[model samples]
Target: MRQWLKGLALFVAITCLVWVGVLWYWQATSRDMSPEDIALYLGLLPLVVFGLALLARWALRSAVASAVAKEAAAAQAPASGSPALPSAGQQERHAPFKLLASGLSCAAGHSAREVADALKEGAPRPAPDKALRDDEGLPVLCARIEPLDTAALQEAWDGVCAVAQADLQGAEAQPVAVDEAVQRALAALQAPLQQCLSQLAAWSERFAKPDADGPQAASAAVPAGLRVFTAWPTHWSPAERAVAQAWVKHCLKQDSADWLAPSQLRLMPSTQGGGVALWLEADRALRAAQREGLPEVVLLLSCQSDLSDARLGHLQREAALFTHTMPKAGVAAESAVALALADETWPELPDAAAAPVLLHRAAVIQRDKPIDAAGRVSAQVAEQVVQQAAAAAELPLAEVSALVSDADQHSPRGAELFSVLVSQLAQLDAAEDTLVAGTLWGRTGPTAPLMLVALAAHRAEMNQQPCLALSVDDSVARMALVLRPPAAAGAEPTKTAS
Candidate 1:
């Protein structure tokens, strides 16, 4: 094609030169030419100029076509196999850095099996030289797996959390050191979650879509557990119950388990009273009646919200007389057999207020804004609202505090005697220590003699007899109460209530 175009250009150039020479010769003798011939030559000059321009264009085009062909041939000779991917030798050349990336990716996975396989048999590193450097200055291939897509990884981390919760309930795990074991397992499970979260963020950026704000928030939070609680005005409906169960199944590996069954859940009336409701729900009703008259109770409850020291005392006072058929157990116990039972026959008590919110110190809601993204809560809001509700129903702050302090020092078993002593000892600096001793009798400080006396008083009350030997040491601000079991009593009940 190039040769043909060059030939055409040469022919046209030659023809134009010949015509120009002939015109010059003719003009030399044109003094005798006719007017009509002059007119004809003028008209033909335009055609000649156009032919010359065309010939020049053709020549340039031919040269370019030849040069491009030669260059293409040279490039092809080098090889273009499989898009010119590096040969094994070329790949080996990059192995030092590439191998490092593979090693790092394997380490990120942290599975012994995966790391073992990678060490034994090499793995694929990502393509492109540019991705070889990341924050660590170490080669970082784009080998990261998107966390949202890594269902297996999420499942593993979530499984650990389920095991921890089960350990608390004494189902899947033995409760030897229940609280400590749970804390350890939870910490271990959350370590890998950082990687999972990083991957999820990457995925969010990759497939970002309009109107994905809600989903983005959900992904960002990455709730720790099965997300059992729900917000108010959005109580657990039939559909929601089903979804919750399904979530439990997926994240907790618990399917058709009685704990997750919807039928097992009861819709009892909401409890009122900062911890008072919990004691009532715990069957301290009979105890309450024995101490203080059943003071027009509004609700029978199994849960409490605020856990301040004051609230705890109020709960204890109410629980002193509360009565029920449900079996009782200590809140903190080591043996699974001695701990609260996990059966339908077992009585349900309100769970303690959750550990303080640790993610963000305080919540802020801008008044002018339609929504407060920073303060808005999904599952936790309900618990707090319930707690605040109970707080609102309580006595004034001063009364609540005094009552709580008194209750802590003395068990409900003998509230009258403890309250009297607390009132009498209010003037002493050792009052605080005494209260602390009564609240935590077995666990008292060495320097607090007054606290030791308070513990003895508690023990005396438990024995249910006059404690005449008891004496209060005015020098050290200490008081002691002593008692013996009733002579006629055959056997004391192993269970005791505060």
Candidate 2:
């Protein structure tokens, strides 16, 4: 009200000054003019001009009001049969998955704890690649993982080959040989996969009977019906994908306390939607397992590396997608992330000591427009997914403590994500409450979404509050999910796992 009054007073003062100036000009220029001519030129003309200005201001206000009303109505309307805002009871019917453990191998660090710490310290920065350059003869910036020990990877590869050969002994199948490139990719994935499976094995051992005699007894105590969902790069060939799948299965068998046999393994390889899609599939698989009375433990894993010169050169040639400018272009990166998800109802799960981090059902939707198009990109899809995720968790947007996203410095992606955050979570401080994974890990390819999830889980556990994880790196789809933590803990937790 005070501001409005001040504006009105300023307008009146300006109008009075204009009228006085006109009157003085009329008198000075035409001293011989009649009084009637003076009144018509000075009084009436000024009055008419003031009235027109007022009329224009009113018209502009009305148009703005109308647009606001239309946008509000559209936001209230459901985009599909599943309402954007579900009631608490409706949300409760959809059970959330418990995030038992997570592992990460990225430019930042080798474990979830290390990665989280590195993020806190801002350790990983996009640096110029020594071997890759853009069209302008400038080095391309990238977040690169340090090269692994070749001898160790080779030893692991030999074991994997032995396991594969033994498993296929009598199946009347031809031998599968993976190319050097695929083997390199598999080697990149080995660290995170081993770390995640080892964590799960350790967790299971915690609940093993005190009287259990040996390692076999602890292995027997490990949960059955384990499922593995792996997301690979779309560029991998059919043979490469098959070999990668075999490698993942063998890794699981080797790390899973000897309880997860090759015959009992259920491996699903996904080449699209990255880690977000894997989480969605894991959710569905958990629900199906519940219905069939199977164990609900599942592992979601993904890895991608663009550190190679060939990959970087290809990105440079694709000028439309990448550029020499750091802020506008997507930075090439290498990363691997693995998450262990389990149903809370699983008898083998030690409920008392489990970290209270729940991954709510993810909401995913496709954007109607291309990401790189000019003009304002509507935040409707992104907003809807966020609302749906919060609703599924039975939590209000206001209660969300932090937001983690895969949005980079690229304008379109950042704009879309910022629009949603500003509109839906008005209480959040942009600088303090938001974390962008791309800033730290660059563009992590298929590993991005899960990496965000792992980070969100870690943040929630540390803050003892809910954190939102958003995946907007996809060209046509937006994904969101909420991670809820316990209301209280003795101190800040170091990792997402129990």
Candidate 3:
């Protein structure tokens, strides 16, 4: 404070003196009214301008530097008896979650084993009804599925949840608002949040979003793990948006948990699943539950379909209505996948299910460059995410068993994935047996994350090795997850004679 004030005072004094001197000289020169005086006065004007520029720069520099320093110091300091910051060497988190079991359902398969078989046999179906377009505006096939209206969503959810051991109860629901459930959940956690909320809000906007209704007392309805979340389209009409919000809540009643969604869920041309996965990992890191043995569970999902029932017939009209021409360059397909993940704490998983795969690491990063080239990862941020994951997992890039990737040649995500591979994993070739789940499963909408994670787990099981899952969202948000197969079991004890 003292230094800044001194700087400001010095700046003001010098500037005022210089301006006064210039005015006086100008008055004197004008009074003389001679040819030399005119030349001298003009010359003095240039000198005056230079003096002022130098003066301003010198004075402001100190003040600005002091201000910036103050802000940085404040940011680093614990505020009003806040928790002390973690030390630099504290790299490992206290609570490390394991994957105990997983459940998956997609067009490719209903179970992890089935998905693995389909990928092994290369049974991906062809794009139907001109789902995508080439750069030349010609038709480019994508892995499309049958219609994905409300009925399809319900049917797929029913089948997938059944396999996942999730039971839905209550009467059938109308397409009404479900915002109240979300609000109540947030309210329930508000007290714990008030303790460390300032810290948590840095990563999740959920805490930062205004609760204009102050807060109601904690509701017994909200559960700890369940996060009621959704990402509705911004261009949607009020009715359309309401249905989307309600869909998530209605779905939550099916599972009976708090709903949480990442901002990435709302609108993105590609990689919605990856984006949400990244946020989910971040939230996990911030959780107060640092219990090692409790483990963690994740449900990841994605879906994409034509804007409406008439999408196939009115492609041209749809293209004209939107400012961007994604309908021209990108494919419109329908897919929905559900994956249930758990860590070692839940060891009672069915023996017949695929062996549990460990999630070694997860990362979400915001890049300086926003993806404009349609699914390209020219941004350096994506490479850093992969490198960080490998380093954190203590796993070498060369040992990657398989890739659960979003960069398929037939899909929009294909543009930048090659760049990521060449830059990050020098050990693997781009043509290596990478599983592009979206391309193979018809580009499931928001459910893509769960589907890919499930696929990664399957790959880990089939090859008895680990795999890397990577995707770039809107070219800026880079999401990555690494899965490792459990270590081989030791020889069973010799049987003793009874």
Highest-scoring model, lDDT? 2
lDDT measured at residue 336 in model 3 versus the true structure, 0 to 100: 42
Tens-place lDDT per residue, model 1, 5-58, is 986776667657756876788878765657776566545654566577678888
Worst-scoring 10-residue span by lDDT in model 3: 489-498
In Å, residue 28's CA in model 2 sits off its true spot by 55
**Which stretches of model 3 miss by more than 4 angstroms?**
1-96, 100-123, 130-142, 146-282, 291-302, 307-328, 342-355, 374-379, 410-412, 429-432, 442-445, 488-498
TM-score to true structure, per model: 0.17, 0.71, 0.52
Two-way lDDT contest, 1 vs 2, winner: 2
lDDT (10s digit) by residue, model 3, range 415-466 = 5676666666666655455766544564343445555666777677667776
Candidate number achieving the greatest TM-score relative to the actual structure: 2
lDDT of 2 by residue, 49-164 (tens): 76787798889999999999999888877563445564544544456677877888777778766776776677777788787676687777778777764465676665566555
lDDT of 2 at 383: 92
lDDT of model 1, residue 329: 10
Model 3, C-alpha of 70: deviation from truth (Å): 29
